[model samples]
Target: MKFNKLPLEEPVLKGVQDLGFLYPTPIQEQAIPSVLNHRDLLGLAETGTGKTAAFLIPILQFITNSPNNKVSGLVLVPTRELAQQVYQDAQALNKYCGLKIVSIYGGVGKFPQTKQLKSGVDLIIGCPGRILDHMRDKTLQIKDLKYLVLDEADTMCDMGFLPDVNKIISETPTSKQTLLFSATMPEPIRKLTKNILKDPVTIQLGNLTSAATVAHTAFPVPSGLKKDLLLHLLDKTPTGKVVIFTRTKYKAKQLARDLSKEDYKVTSLQGNLSQSQRTNAMNGFRKGKYDLLVATDIAAHGIDVSEVTHVINFDFPGTTDDYTHRVGRTGRAKQSGQAFSLITPEDKQLFNQTKKKLDIEIPLESFKDFDYGIFNPSTFNDPIKRNSQTQSGETKPKKPPHFYRKSAGNKYRKDVNGYRRSRSSSSGEKMKTHTSSNNYKRRVRPKSKSKV
Candidate 1:
């Protein structure tokens, strides 16, 4: 259905046309009417299925009709990146309607956010943690809120934001209309809906398991050779835009660094970076400044990059739902895309479960000329180590070996000297070293007062 076919106001129709959206996505087509009727909605759709517009269009229409200058609509997301994305989408949708929208999230100055709240906004798009911070400071008032949306409800549950979400919901009036949109409805998300939504209409677009447009392929290699396989695939496989996923932030950063050193336009999105750095990385990727983005699952949420031809999973996600979310980045907007995952013996069970549960037939591919040697768990610690040797029997220059040791409940890295140094891990905390090389022999350091 088209935007004009719906009961949207003239201003909304103008905005829709301005954005060049002639047809509505399946989710948007079904969700807009339910939201227009003021019914609670539980929308099940994948990331690239226009879920953001599904809720934003209806909410913009509602706000445009009501003409509220105070905060009338609230959208709670799991990550700051997602919050910014939703806020930008809302602004675009509200262009003709002239609704005041503000996004709030941690890792930045709360003063500016407070100033925006004090100036008064009609809609708020934010994460739960920053929203709670504003609530505590009495800078944000939602008692007059009429529409509440939990975008990516499943992700919120995964991030342990349900309790904070409930508290924020309580701050709003019970008569408010609630809309929950998720790719998959796990038990926790279902429970959240039961407690929050009232007589909601469920709109399920496709099978909640995986995206239909993505072609799934897995390459099983020894863990030690996974990075080599990744490099081989990336070098040979032609793609327009690509996003790589890693299990940890450290791995994402390290992988991106290694790829950049190889002269690839690559950047990383992870938790360790400051808010500005994250924004720069994301904006750079969106603006086509970077061809590849390596990111962890949590940090990659709310990323909507068009023309992403490939999604490479360097490390298998913990759950099938996460795999779906990662691969959903591609094959968007009726475009076909490929998903390649570097699978190893450790991910055997996960690979089997993903195939069985998601009903996806992932054909295994191998590099005919590449060596799949015996798996060494230590060599898998860093991607640079994997590329040390080439197919032509050439070796790259190796860096100094680092050792990890636990001392007095604190983890530190031991260098060539008999001193311990601390480094940041995926969690952004100074912890034990994560990299080890087979060339270096393990040495135990004696107790010493010197710290390096």
Candidate 2:
């Protein structure tokens, strides 16, 4: 369906025409009408599927029709980059209509955003934390809010911002039209919708399991050799506008730095960077200043870079949903792309689960010149266990260690080297340390529940 065929105002249609968008995307084709009808909407769409425009267009139309000077519309996003992108899209669509819109996010100073709020914005696009701050300061009031949108709700849940989101939602009037959009809906998001939306129209554009446009491949490699294999793949594969995902912020930064030294136009986009730095990295990546963006899952939601040729998983994703979001970064706008992951024995379970759940074939590829005989597990912080061959030729990892170790009344003692050692019982009991690699777990504490 075309934009003109939908019941859009003349100014909104003119803006759409100016952008040269002849036909509405699949999500847009269905969601715009439901949004226009003023019904609560729950839309499931993949990344880069024009879902942003789908809701933005109808919201702009509603605001244009009413022309309320108060903050009538509010869009809550998960990241600063997404807030900026949505603000830009709102500006482009509201050009002829001339609606006062402002984007508020953390990372930068609040003085500018305060001035904009003081000037009286018709629509507000912001993250939950900063918006809650504004509400507390009495600078921004949304009691008269007519439209409320929760974009990238799953990302907010992942970032531990759902509590703040709930607080913000409690402030808004229940009479307002609510719209929730996500690429994939997890249980938390579903629970959120149950509380926020009332009998909403559900529009799902595609399968929620995986991106059909992406070709999946897994390279069996030791965790120690992942970086080398990534480098090898980068040298061998043909790519344009690639995004490499790491599991942790430190890894993303270090990998980006290491790749930069090798003359690769690469930049990191993890949470460690300031707002300006994040914006610069994204802008540079979009403008072709950088060919590669090494990021955590923060970039997985609402980053609208076009023509992303490949998504390389330097580390295995934590869950199947994570795999979906990471791979969804590529193959956008109906373009076919490739996703490659370097897997170790530790990642085998999750990889197999993802493959089975997505019901997709991921061929195991071996580089012709790379030697697979050099199996090194000591390079990792904890050694990766390998399957032992038995008499019947069945392979199984050795029995796992006991969970709790027997400790004496003096629990821990510091050795001369300053390392803490667990004391054994006075009965001369041997303390068996659980050296199983899977026993080691890393917990990343959220800096702030309110921060994006």
Candidate 3:
């Protein structure tokens, strides 16, 4: 459906045209009307499904019609990055409407936010923690808040921000219209919907599986050879604004550093960095300053870069939902995208589990020239198995036997005998031996000495 046909105000329609949005996505088509009718809505769609516009457009229309200078709409997100992105979109859509919009979040100063709040904003886009802070200090007031949107509600639950979210919701009037949107509807989110939304309209766009427009593929290689395979794939694929998802912040940083060393314009977004650093990385990637962005799941929340042609999973995601969110970054707004995952032998179980849960077959691809060294799953049982049968049968040092240790106060007792001795409570005597051992040494090692 075309956005122009929707019951949007003239100013909002002009803003939509100015932003070059002629057609409405499926979620937007279904959600804009319900929002315009002031009905509670539960929008189930992944990131980049035009869910932002689905809610933002109607919100702009409402605020433009009412012309309220006070805060009427409140959007609670999980992260500061998402808050910033949503605020930017709100500003763009409300350009012709001339509504005041302010984004609030932690990890930065709150004085400016308080000043903006005092100046009176029509809408607030902020994270849960910072929004609660403003509520506590009475810097931001939402007593008469008309519209409440919990964008990425499932993410807020995952981040353990539901308590803060509930508190913020409590501050708002119960008569307010609530809109909860998420990529997946888990049990907690469902319960939240029951408690908050009053007879809301539920809109489910796609399944929990990957997007239909995205091509899912995997390359099974050893952990050590993943970087080589990624480089090969990057060299071969015709990609623009590729995003690589890593499991850890350290890995994202290191991967970005390594990619940068190879002369690829790469940056990273992770929790460890400062807010300004994260903002810079996101802005740089959006502005084409970086061709590739190596990030953790934080980027999977609300990153809305339109030119993302590909999403590469440098490491397998922790869950099927995360995989969906990561891949959802691409194939957005009806645009086709490619999702590639670098799989190691250890990740096979997780990959298979995710595939089974999503009920989607991810094709396995291998490069013709790429060399996948001897990676045997059976060799995992015996580390020396591969080296022991080399062409030049050279004897290598066997790995040390594993030992268990228990800490007694500051000192550690190494149980080389493989059996822990129990003391009789009544007599304070050692119990009978459960196993026989040749070495029975009771050495008192200093607690200050480091164990190797």
- The sequence of per-residue lDDT tens digits that candidate 1 reaches over residues 16-98 is 89999999988888988999999999998888888899889888888888876799999999999999898898888888988
Total colliding residue pairs, candidate 3: 0
Clashes of each: 0, 0, 0
Model 3, which residues run further than 4 Å from truth? 376-452
Q: Give the Cα lDDT of each candidate.
A: 0.80, 0.80, 0.80
Error of 1 at 38 (Å): 0.8
Off by over 4 Å in 2: 299-302, 375-452
Instruction: Count residue pairs with overlapping backbones in model 2.
Output: 0
* CA-only RMSD, every prediction: 13.2, 12.3, 15.4
Model 2, 1-452: lDDT tens per residue? 77889999899999999999999988899999988888999988767688889889999999998886899999999988899999999999998999999999998999999999998899999999999999999999999999999998888899899999999988889899999988788899989999999999999877775567787877766654567777777776667888999999988998998888666889999898988889999999999999889999875465678678788999999988788888888888788878888878678679778888877777666665664334422221222335578789887754543222221222333221111122222322121211211211322222434666
Q: What's the lDDT of the predicted structure labeled candidate 3?
A: 0.80
**Model 3 TM-score, all chains together:** 0.82
Model 2 quality (TM-score): 0.83
